[model samples]
Target: MKLYHSVDTRSLRCVWLLEELGVSYDLDVVPFPPRVKAPEFLAVNPLGTLPYLVDGDTKMSESVAILEYLLNRYDGGELRLTPDEADYGSWLNWMHFGEASLANIQATILRYTLFLPKPQRLPVVGEDLSVFLQERLKVLDAGLQGKTYLCGERFTAADISVGYALLLSSLFGYQKYFTPAITVYFDRLQSRAAYQAARAKS
Candidate 1:
């Protein structure tokens, strides 16, 4: 199996999964272009995004899908989070919340920082997004209350999927609403040796 990776991007999630899974895979690092428009890259995915994966016959385009694929295929090599995990119901809920809430946070950040020109950038929406992210974090903070990992005691693939987005917020220079538990959780996620390795490569 092989994973195509990129540094300072969501591909770190895939690399983090690969490291956690302890699977031997080669990485092909592709530099992000200033303007992401290329026929060859677009052929891989219409969105032309990073963190793409290929395992012999399988091709995965999203980080969450890739994380789940790694978990099911490798028997939870490191982080055993499966949608059908022993804690399936809750895991599934976190996964859905992660996708929906994080998507809004990411899209809003991009529109202000990169997607829009100086004159076109809307600070109002960015401020609105800041409020939205805070509101969403409260729910996450509550879900994480009295828990070590998202799914109780053991670390799982869900952590990698969601944790990667938190890392994104940090990389993007946001440091406003990190609570004590969230801080602890992020520290735990970062403390994993696999996460360290992934961070080095990323």
Candidate 2:
């Protein structure tokens, strides 16, 4: 298996999970916004999206989907919650929630605040996004109030999925709005050996 990734992007989620699963895979670190910085990558994936994975004949792009694929395909079932598990629904919800809800807001904020040129940057839009993000974070903070992981005591793929959004919050300077529960949860995630390894390698 091989993964095309960009440091600090959603691709880190896949790298983190791969480390936790102790799987042997190739990591191709590419420049961010690959369509511009690495035009050659466009031939491989027309979308030029990061977190692209190629495993034999299988290919994937979405970060959360790639995590599920890795778990199911690489004999990493230990980190997966089956359909019969009580927390399965919650697990799926939180996993997709991280990217669909949190990261989507973060990306928009980035576009308005940093990605665009100074003259194009919109302070009002960035501020509104920050407020919106804080409101969304409330759900995550509440969900983590009494649990070590999103689903429960076990460290599952859901944590990796959500943890990447938390990681993005910190990197993008929105962590100031992180609630107490979120702060503790992010700290726990950062302390993991696999998380550390993924960070160093990225």
Could you give candidate 1's per-residue lDDT for residues 1-202 as a string of tens digits? Answer: 7666678676787798888777899887766741253446666666777767878889887777787788788787546644444677778667656656865487676789667879988888788788888888788788899999898777877777778777867776654577788888988999999999998984
Q: Highest TM-score, which number?
A: 2
| Candidate 2 regions with alpha-carbon error over 4 angstroms | none
**C-alpha TM-score for every candidate:** 0.87, 0.95
lDDT of 1 at 147: 92
What is the C-alpha lDDT profile of model 2 across 1-202, one tens digit per residue? 8999998899999999999999999999999899999999999899999889999999999999999898888876768888998888988899899998899899999999899989999989989988889888999988988888887678888889889998998997889989888998889999999999999875
RMSD of every candidate to native, in Å, equals 2.4, 1.2
lDDT of each: 0.75, 0.90
